[model samples]
Target: MSEIPPDLRYGDSHEWVRAEDDGTVVVGISDHAQGELGDMVFIELPEPGMNYNQGEACAVIESVKAASDIYAPLSGEIVQANGELEDSPELVNSDPYGEGWLFRMIPSDPAQIDGLMNAEAYAGQLARILHEGGPINT
Candidate 1:
């Protein structure tokens, strides 16, 4: 079974978001996403000072089989990125929602997060996608 953290919000695109107490949000690909992508070999993260709109592509994770884009779940200014991923991309495969997080951003509008699916909804969406035999985007 894929490990789904109960506190994070999820995008239809399979990215996970965890809001920090400091107002920055942590972003990452979910376990189901890493499973579908296979072994991640490389990750390209956004620069710390970059800004992105909601749903905009901001990074890339390359696996042995495919390259996947990582989108911003909400409009935000990137405050930090996981530089550790460059040297140890496998963290994504092992602990995706924890130490494997991709970046941190200060949301342009925190309310945008209310529009994303919670853990239960995301799990249902994942189940529905699997039932429909659709490709799981990372």
Candidate 2:
């Protein structure tokens, strides 16, 4: 079973968002996503100051199974990237919600975060795709 933390907002592409008190939001792939991808071998984090619109592919994560794009959960400028992943991509598989975070961003429209799916909704979608064996509508 995947660990779906109750407090985070999720994107259709399996990216998770955690808003920080500092006005920046941290971004990472959901635990379910990491599990599906298998062991991560390489991760390419977006550079700080780079901007992306919601749903845009901003980073790359290569696992033993395949290489996947990590999309932006909200329109924002990346403020900080996790430098540790460059050296330890396996952290993605080990601690996806914590030390495995990819980047932090300053949202272009903070209100847009509210438009993302909550954990319950994401869990529902996850179960639907698993049980139905159909692709998510991302």
Candidate 3:
């Protein structure tokens, strides 16, 4: 079973969001997602000042197997991106929920986050996907 951290919220698209103390939310591709993507080779992250709507494609991560888009879980203006990814894209595979975090954003409306799935709900989603046989693009 993949490790799903209890504190983060997840999107059906396999993105995870963690709220920070400074009103910014940290975003990343979940462990399940990294596993599906295989060995990550590169990432194209959004600019720090870019504004994105909920569900928008904010970045792209390419692995040995495929390229996948990373979506915004909520509408927000990007505040920062993990520049370390340029040099160490493998961090996504090594520490997906921590040092592998992709970006941080200041949400346009904090309440938008409430619509995202909690950890349990995401776990159920993952189970359903496994039962159905592998990742389903949404």
Candidate 4:
């Protein structure tokens, strides 16, 4: 089973969001997502200051197994991106929620994150998908 961090809000598409005290949110694919994708080989993240709508594809992560799009968890402008991933994409596989974080964005509405699945809900969703034999996509 993948680790679902209790502090982060999860998107149905398998992204996780952590609201920062500065009113920005750190975004990354869930551990479940990275596991499904396999060892990450490349990552293409949006430049800081780019705007996106909720659910829009904002970045791309390529793994040895497949390439997957990373969606925006909430509408906002990107404030920062993790530059280290460009040199060591394996960080996604090693520490998905920490050094592997893709970007930080100032949400148009921070409350939007509250609508996402909690850790428990996301875990159940993952379990259901696995039980149904559905392949875990990005």
Candidate 5:
């Protein structure tokens, strides 16, 4: 089973977001996403100062199994991108919710974060996908 941390909000396509007290939010792929993608090889991180709408493709994650776009979980201006992942993509597989985080942003509207799934909803979505044998957020 995937590690679904209760504190994070989840995107339907598999990204997770954690709101910070400073009005920024951290974003990354969930443990379930990396697990399904097999081993991480490279991640094209977004640039600081770039703006993207909710659900816009911002980065790309490549694994041994396949490559997939990492979308913006909310409309925002990217405040920072994780530089370490450029050198150590495997951090995504090793510690997904911590060191593997992809980017940070100042949301265009903080309330959009609230519209995403909570841990329980995300877990149920994953269960339904698994039971139905649907392809995970590829």
Candidate 6:
């Protein structure tokens, strides 16, 4: 089963978002995503100042199993990216929700966050994926 923390919001595409104290949102691939990816080898993150619409592909993650696009869960401009991942992509496999987080963004509309899936919804989606015997559409 995938780890779905109750505090974070999730996208059907597998991106997770955590609202930070300083008004930025931390973004990352979910545990289910990294697990399906298998031993991440590289990540192409968005630039600090770049803006993206919700549902846009903002980054790329490659692993031994497959390569996947990381989508923006909300419309926002990136504030900072995790430079550490360029040197140690395995962090995505090791701790996807914590140290492996991809980027931080200042949301264009904070209220839009409410539209994302909660932990229970995300878990149900993960369960469906597992029952189907394959990863989600990437």
Candidate 4 vs candidate 5, TM-score winner = 5
lDDT of 2 by residue, 1-138 (tens): 899999999999899999999899999998989988899999899999899998898999999988888888999999999999999999988999999999999999999999999999999999998999885332
For model 6, residues 1-103, the per-residue Cα lDDT tens digits are 6788999999889889999999999999899888777899989999999999999998999998777888889998999999999999999889999999999
lDDT against the true structure, each candidate: 0.92, 0.91, 0.91, 0.92, 0.94, 0.91
Query: Each model's number of backbone clashes?
Result: 0, 0, 0, 0, 0, 0
lDDT of 3 by residue, 8-119 (tens): 8998798999998999999998898898888999999999999999988889999999888888899989999999999999999999999999999999999987888989
Of candidates 6 and 4, the better by TM-score: 4
TM-score of each: 0.97, 0.96, 0.97, 0.97, 0.98, 0.95
Displacement of the residue 124 alpha carbon in candidate 5, Å:
0.5
RMSD to the true structure for each prediction, in A, is 0.7, 1.3, 1.0, 0.7, 0.6, 1.1
Instruction: Please tell me which predicted candidate would have the highest TM-score against the true structure.
Output: 5
User: After TM-score superposition, what is the CA distance of residue 93 in candidate 1 from its true location, in Å?
Assistant: 0.3
What is model 4's C-alpha RMSD? 0.7
| Candidate 5 residue runs with Cα over 4 Å from true position | none
In model 1, pairs of residues that clash are none
Q: Give the TM-score of candidate 5.
A: 0.98
Question: What tens-digit string does per-residue lDDT give for candidate 4 at 1-138?
Answer: 889999999998999999889898999999989988899999999999999999999999999988888889899999999999999999999999999999999999888998999999999999999999897767
User: What value of lDDT does candidate 2 attain over all alpha carbons?
Assistant: 0.91
Best by lDDT: 5
